[model samples]
Target: MKRALITGVTGQDGSYLAEHLLRCGYEVWGLLRGQPSPHRSRISRIADDLKFVEGDLLDQSSLVAAVDRAQPDEVYNLAAISYVPMSWQQADLTGEVTGLGVLRMLEAIRMVSGIGRSGTTSMAGQIRFYQASSSEMFGKVREVPQNEDTALHPRSPYGVAKTYGHFITRNYRESFGLFAVSGILFNHESPRRGREFVTRKISRAAARISKGLQSELRLGNLDAVRDWGFAGDYVKAMHLMLQQGNPGDYVVGTGRTHSVRDAVRIAFETVGLDWSRHVVCDSRLVRPAEVDLLCADPKRARAQLGWEPTVDFDELVRMMVEADLERAEREQRDVARAPTEPEGDW
Candidate 1:
């Protein structure tokens, strides 16, 4: 079986990609910095199936060791300081992990693949690399429905870091002739999405309010637009990138834009609630630098990779809301079953 090592395997995209690789008969190994906890519910279902390699993006030696241990035919660098607001607070950390870390991974791959001083490979050109580039790179877009050729004008520290990563990936591909590709992915979400993300937060709040568990949902930038797709569908495109005869950057997205208000409205409507009743606009939550709009032009991905998104916007929202609703119901049931403290215990 082919061996694949995926960084950030516990994340939504990584979890879906792991499942995809497993089904394709690949021996999947995950690079993790710490002990695997059940709390990583995204990958909990397949945790036992994954081999773990201890490593950190911030540590080049650890990454080299991980590459040596896994001996993967392909390496997916998905681990990064992904959150935008957090990137602002920890700019230096994001720079180390999200930006410079790509260089370390490329170097590790070079050493492992036996690429010589001339930067040419001999082991049948093995050890392909896929860097998870983000649509956030198109912060202040120069054109509508951004393609691979659009100029990057990143606004946030996270986007700037990703832009660096993207350039380096392309640089290595050109200079070293490494089989490296970067997928400029748009905003993709799923039920496994962390609650810190706006989509998940909205879905969770909608589910909670439907069951009378939450009073209100505070949000910022309801007018901000994003091109969203299903995480599962996007992972297929990642896999397809490696299967190609040549390496090139591709934009992966739904080719449509939807506002945060649209997501919140659809989420609430799914659960038979009016969003205006519960949503509170909090200016404090707004980003210091916001990308007003981001939509993708995935013509290349479609024409070249033979890939297309299977889930639509309404369906995606419905799926997230339903999953959150199920979780809330389970939590409510657990609370009901727990033994109560004595009335005078306090």
Candidate 2:
């Protein structure tokens, strides 16, 4: 069977992508820093079928060893400290994990059995790579709908680091003739989304308030706009990028932008609530630097990959809200049956 490796396999996108690859009949392997992490209720199920490998992206030895063991035909580099606000607090560690980490993996492949001389690409069977590029890189909003050729002016350290990962993938493809591609993915969401991300945070909060589990949801910057899609749909775009005759970059998104307020309204409407009473905005919760608006221009991906988003915003919101309700019900039932548990960080 064809084999593929994914970093950040415990994350929302990673879980969805692993399911996609498994359905396609590939043996899927995931890169995790330590032991399998405790899953968020919405994502706990995907944890069962996946195979986890112990490795660290920041450590060259671990990367080389993991890659050598997996010998994957395709490697999806989805691992990064992705949240923009978190980047402000963890800038130094973010620089190490989000920026330099890509180079470490590339170097590890080049030196499969030996040490890599600086500035070199990999040897044969080094594995075709797909970097998880983001629309956040177009930080200043040069154009209404961003495409591959758009000039990037990343405002946050997270965007800047992802830009490095994007260009380095392209550089290796041009310089060493490696099969490396970058997919500039826009905001994709699912029920598995962390509570910190606005979409899930809104959905989870709505589910709670609707069920009388929580009174309010605290958020920041409702005016901020994002182009969001279903995570399952976006994962298909990643697989399509590698299946092309030769590796090429593509922009994958729903090509629609909605404000954080609009998202709140949708989630509230789904759960039947007045958003004003429930959503309490705190100035402290906002990001240090925010990308005001992002909408994808998918003309190239449409013509080339024959891809278009299957889920629209309303459907996406409803689905996420429903998932949140189901999870809350499950948690309530579990808690009632078992003893009270201590709070834990996800």
Pick the TM-score winner.
Answer: 1
Residue 223 error for model 2, in Å?
Answer: 1.2
Q: Which regions of candidate 2 are displaced past 4 Å?
A: 40-49, 113-126, 334-346
Model 1 Cα lDDT, one tens digit per residue, 1-346: 8999999898889999999999999999999889755436777888888898999888889988999999998999998889999999999999999999998999888887777657764326489999999999999999998999999999999999999999999988887879999999999999988889999999999998998888999999999999999999999999999999988999999999999999999999999998999999999999998999999999999999999999999999999999999999998999899999778955
Model 2 global lDDT (CA atoms, 0 to 1): 0.86
Model 1 stretches with alpha carbons more than 4 Å out: 36-39, 121-123
Candidate 1 all-Cα RMSD: 1.5
- TM-scores of all predicted structures: 0.97, 0.91
Per-model RMSD to reference: 1.5, 4.6
lDDT of 2 by residue, 259-300 (tens): 999999999998889999999999999877778999999888
After TM-score superposition, the amount by which residue 226's alpha carbon in candidate 1 deviates from its true location, in angstroms, is 0.5
